[model samples]
Target: MTTSRGGDGQSSVEVGTFIKTPSAHIVEILAVAGLDFAVLDAEHAPFDFGTLDAMLIAGKAAGLPLFVRVPDFQPSTLLRSLDLGAAGVLVPHVDTPEDARNVVARCRYKAGVRGYSGGSRSSGYGEKGMLAAVADAESVQIMCQIESIEAVDNTRAIAATQGVDGIFVGRADLALSMGLADSQHPDVLKATERAIAAGVSQGKRIGVVASSLEERKRYSDLGATWFLHGSDQSLLKQAARALVRA
Candidate 1:
């Protein structure tokens, strides 16, 4: 994870970017651009195991903590992502404390029903041994996305859910659920604030996707400790547009 510096020379928040292209080259570019970490947007992008493996290998070589945002809260997907050596996993549409709990359970062997196997790549393919592998797997971060009004109302309970490391606000979906097209609407902001406060009160780190550096700072000020900005596809479009104008 990478922390951004404020005027005071201290970084209160960590920042990264989202990857949607499923390319190892894109992941390498993120590393060279000095990003601290990255999340493969598997929820929207199609990535087979070979592709994920390639990106994960690239991320490792670049010394970046690569994570995967699974399409759902399925235990098999979570387990497979971890087995692919993701630093963590982000599960989407977590609407209740129970959902959050289940996500965490899938990430850990002792607490939940994650099928254990030390022969996976995450365990050094048996090099690290089974006992040590279990411990390492347990340390992987689990981030639950709170994307609905129901989740916002149950924010405190979700944050307090054991083994949950953080809560990521999916503003776009939250906005859609509120019958709005703008995520910056007053109601959406209010719900975001409430979720942030609940996470802070429970001593859990809060996360959000920032469209710009300014927005990132704004969310940081609002107690969002983790921020993801931009994406491979968006960056490509912006660059291509600039080139056309040039």
Candidate 2:
């Protein structure tokens, strides 16, 4: 139900791209280009803790919100990302309400078991004081990814879970899990719609990775507010290909 607003104070579709290059300069460039956000693809990319630490710092310096897509549902991974000052986390393969609940439990403090460290960057290195720090940390966005058929069926419940800030539909994995080769296959589209609709019904923000402007519009029409258009690698490859053609 929450929307990202532009400088003009108008609600606009949130646009971002996947950060797979593992470069702090790339993160700065994306922010300078005016992207609404960026997700460091730690799940698929070779980003170690030190690398992530530098990139997160770059994102902060560039005035960009950087969310990390963690490799798994490990509490340690989530804890580390948050500790390093990631804006939020995109937890993948959250197939059930229990999984969603577990994510919330791991990321929160008062209501869950997130380890506390006043010296961490997230707490402003003990400058913000414990109460203010806990408040800010708990405010970090927590999005659950719906990637499989089972996840689609439970999308509503997952969105309905408290502390779940949004639902991100992972169509690529959904297609593969459904035995399809195309992410845009009709069945995949249908499942995407179903998941989005379920999240909307629960009054949750919806997000998706759209390969093209048309694809982004299609999902936008289906109630997806946040869109990740492509990855740094894909965009670079495209620019290089276009340059060679030119």
Name the candidate that leads on TM-score.
2
Candidate 2 lowest-lDDT run of ten: 1-10
Write the residue-wise lDDT of candidate 1 on 87-146 in tens digits.
Answer: 998889999988988888888988678887777889998899878988887779888899
- Tens digits of per-residue lDDT for model 2, 1-246: 247666975446999999999899999899989998999999999999999999999999999999999999798999999999999999999999999999999999979989999999999999999999888877899999999999999999999999999999999999999999899899999999999999989878899998889988888777788999889999999999999999
Q: For model 1, which pairs clash?
A: none
Task: Please tell me which predicted candidate would have the highest lDDT against the true structure.
Answer: 2
Which sections of candidate 1 miss by over 4 Å? 1-11
lDDT of 2: 0.92
Q: What is the TM-score of each candidate against the true structure?
A: 0.93, 0.96
Alpha carbon lDDT at 47, candidate 1: 87
Give candidate 2 misplaced runs (Cα > 4 Å): 5-11
